[model samples]
Target: MRRSFKISFLLIVMMICVLSGKCRAGDRFIRNSAFKGDRQIIVTFAGPVSDVWANDISNFTVNEKPDPDIMLEIEDSTLSLDKTSLVFTFKDPLNREVPHCLTLKQIIADGRSQGTATVTLRKNYLAHLFSVFLGAVLIQNFVFVKYLGLCVFLGVSQKKSTAVGMGITFTIVIVFASMLSWFLYRFVLKPYHLDFLQVIVFIGLVSLTVQGIDTVLRKVNPALFKSFGVYLVLVISSCIILAVPLMLAANDYDMFESLMLSLGAGVGFLLALFLMASVRERLELANVPTPFRGMPIAFIITGLFALSFMGFSGMSLF
Candidate 1:
């Protein structure tokens, strides 16, 4: 009986080893590929794997270069168990237009051996910047697309000069406020789980920023302030001003991206204001029915502008 039991135990161990080997052989495959930013490349596997061997510099190649560049460092590589992903952060930004290939040879994950997985990095910062700019100015436009800041858009856009001033002011304020709000949300409220206070905090921040700008403008350019100071103060209540920080916070954009978005939004607002001011100026001379002369005609023109901006939809730089 003892001899038979020992033989059975050895047979079971051998079967287990074979099964494990087969499992490892069949499970090696790439799941997805993406970029963290302009530099870091993330490659995910279908199954979990040991990153110890995979992180080696010799195991990876970029652009099929036979001789690796001295600038490329292996220490920048990282592995995440939670997502079953390997991250390779390049020391510098890769060329945007060129198609770059990253090849992983003899990579092992979840005790399974993967032969080779190659991922092409096609995303670039310029494309991303253009996308952001296009999206903000056209697709998700602050005034026409989103219908935000209508109060100032219609009120201040009565004249080309006022429209220009308001556009500049809105751009400056939006950029500064969005950046400051990002820092506050990322570093303070988010870490402490004080998200409930976001609205109050954002409103307060925007009000203070507008007030600060108003104070400075009053001192620096009294004539300009006298002309547009009321509108600047009124911006404290402008939905666009408040919406910028809120949108940035909600989207969880980084500092640079938030700034880009703010600038885009500002420029879009400026464009809308300028366009509307120009149209209204022309409308003054056109013969129109008395019933549709002022506000009605203005609304119709605004709607037309909105429709025209819609043509930019589905347009992307990437």
Candidate 2:
């Protein structure tokens, strides 16, 4: 037992070191020996930071004097986790170069003043966007991978028509949830340093957005709302819808990539829903065990659908 404990302790220590190394590897630091003051310094980050913090943490001391012209700030954090890249902006906006360490130091000093730290910027655009899209659709898919919102996935997938409608609704809700969450995170919570309130704020946002969407749909098209609103309730407070955006916002994906991720996730949800619905409808006519009539068969069908989506691996449509 003692030997086992020692082994476990060593493993924990090694893991901690590895994690700490990764965390510190992103620190924005520049040594004076590497300084080339003549050239414009471009720094890109792979994490989160604020403009005020960037200005504060990023310092410039040229010949031991504060270098005003050397300061740099975030151009944007919108990045694709799959296929994204950053284009460095120079004093001449048209001129671009690879980001280096010096610029990062300037950003860190800037962020320090603003009470923020280095935020990671996307290094490769195309790869990151593609990675994000694929990850959402496959690795962390809302349906098969994360198994979130299964209630709606199974409940509304009874007919192809209903499935499509639910899919469309799901997409819209997810996108809206992402947008609202991003806004609340950046504007409301972060400002007050109440970052822990993310969960509460997001839940509030989702409920309010769903309610608003439901009200609008009822006012505009009562029949559509009547038919799909039931399913909407099932999805109304889903964490998946809000979680994706919160994650994207935290990681600082650009607008387009965020949209793409939401879209891909919606698609994955639709795909699962449609497949399950088709299987369940067919099962209704087939001889199913009495014990496994409704939910049991539906669950079995979902399992099969999940298995099938797994086959989509190693295939890239985009």
Candidate 3:
């Protein structure tokens, strides 16, 4: 009877200690951690850590998330003034496009040795892709921003009917040309070391895309084909069309990035045509002075448009 009573008392004592947070010797943990930039990581602990353990580079591990194979070499580590955070500097910049993991092992905080804890610094692929698309469309527009495709912007924008037709036709041609150029550059030319042939090859691809589009339109809609007679050929020489493929190759953009940029450029060009056409149509009905009439007024308006687009140069949607 005494033995049973003693065992029950000991069990009650243990439960009380556990419930009061006295059973565990170490409960200090990580509050959160994040990357400050491409070359630094900052970790904040739930409680103050001992400088000896927190500043020791050997007690921490930093690497790309979900893949321990790529380890980052720490150039140096510093504990915060309050000892609640540790900042780790890397020897080189991390891939800003990838998430990284930081492991805090042998943590000594709150006068006790705590277990290992890990924090993941996340990467948002969707946000990055969105920023790229927005950059091409508004921040780096091919027509107003880079001054390319002005020939088409001014030529077709005289009439709303022709401007709409040209915009649609240009979009289809450029998207197709850019995609095909990427495939050839990645698979064919890159393998054979035919780098020098890029300019000639890209031009040929543009010509081919234009030809295919020409045939389809001629068959399905003869009136539309006649309306686009010379302008369709002019698209073959437009700077924006050729520049996109060359930029994709130079930047080594992946398939999705290439597609987004190409599409964004097309939409941006369409926007320019539409805006210019609308204003030009209004100008046709308005009374105007003779000297500042046709092309002079057009150039002035384009200049104002360029200045307006400059405001979006550093804008980020993500």
Candidate 4:
């Protein structure tokens, strides 16, 4: 009993450390604030050994003298594995409280040739919100550009009733997934330097959470579940349930940005799915060649729908 108690105590302490930020996965122990200067750069490695080849990297002004107003520091740890590559980035760290067009890229390798690239920080709140609205609606539309969740898009879209049901379902799942992912990331994986574990962790947690929610709903509200239970299985298969949360976590978005993203993504997914279903319902009677009967023609129509959504670009709605 004493041995077991000791082990349990150690585990609890480790969990506390991971949440408290004593350790971290990415480089830059400090979260870079939007300071008056050019930019801030940070790089991390897989293992304790220094492996970043920061030479020849362009697009930033280099200083030959002492460290400029901005500087980078490298640390080595012997506890990490050397195989897999991991990258953790926030698209809008400067204006994380708002929204913006953010990009994060990380490449991991064995040799000393591993690095990450992140750009597009929101300068202020107004610009970030505008960009977020516009980007969600049209530019980085969840359906057209990313081709995220399409199974339900073409499945439950036959009737207006079913479409509404599926839309509500999608929104709830996305919101829950996004919130859960952010919690796991901010509170669990990130501090322990286990960011590479995101995919498996997210999949397992989302599957379990959705299943638990489904069970609870079935027990508490049988009628609603009966009406939408058919869609639960479909929702589990839809990648958007997993993708939206992972995207928000990876981007390090604030609560508002994450919520906006989830809502916008849900809308985009619903729009595409409903529109496709409606058009296909009408196209059933249209004349088509034998080679393009069911799926072939559906694909053709989907391509057109994607093309049409592109016209909403350059419009700021946020």
Winning model by TM-score:
3
Task: For candidate 4, write residues 1-318 as lDDT tens digits.
Answer: 896899688657646744464222333321332322223323233344323422213222322122244323212211124422222232222323331221223433344333453332334555665566558757878778778777667667667678877877877777777766776787689889999998998888778767876997899899999987777777778888888778877777655567678777777777776777778778877898999987778778878978887777655443
| Candidate 4, lDDT over the whole model | 0.60
lDDT tens digits, residues 1-318, model 1?
Answer: 896899688657645743563331122377766666667778787777676776676888775222335334444778885747888877777544344567778777667776776666555656776777778988888888889988778787888988898888888888878776877897799999999899999988888888887888899899988877867776676798889888888877655567789999999999999999998888888998999977888888999988988888766566
Model 2 vs. true fold: TM: 0.57
**How close is each model in CA RMSD to the real structure?**
20.0, 18.0, 17.4, 14.3
Candidate number with the higher TM-score (3 or 4)? 3
Mark the regions of model 4 whose C-alpha exceeds 4 Å error after superposition. Answer: 1-127
Question: How big is the positional error of residue 292 in model 4, measured in Å on the Cα after superposition?
Answer: 1.2
TM-score for predicted model 1 compared with the true structure: 0.64
Judged by lDDT against the true structure, how good is candidate 3? 0.81
For 172-216, candidate 3 gives per-residue lDDT tens digits of 788989987987897788889998899999999999989988887
Looking at model 1, which ten-residue stretch has the lowest summed lDDT? Answer: 19-28
What C-alpha lDDT, on a 0 to 100 scale, does residue 278 get in candidate 1? 95
lDDT of 1 at 244: 86
Q: How far is candidate 1 from the true structure (C-alpha RMSD, Å)?
A: 20.0
Q: Which stretches of candidate 1 lie over 4 Å from their true place?
A: 1-122, 221-224
Point out the higher-scoring one by lDDT: 1 or 2.
1
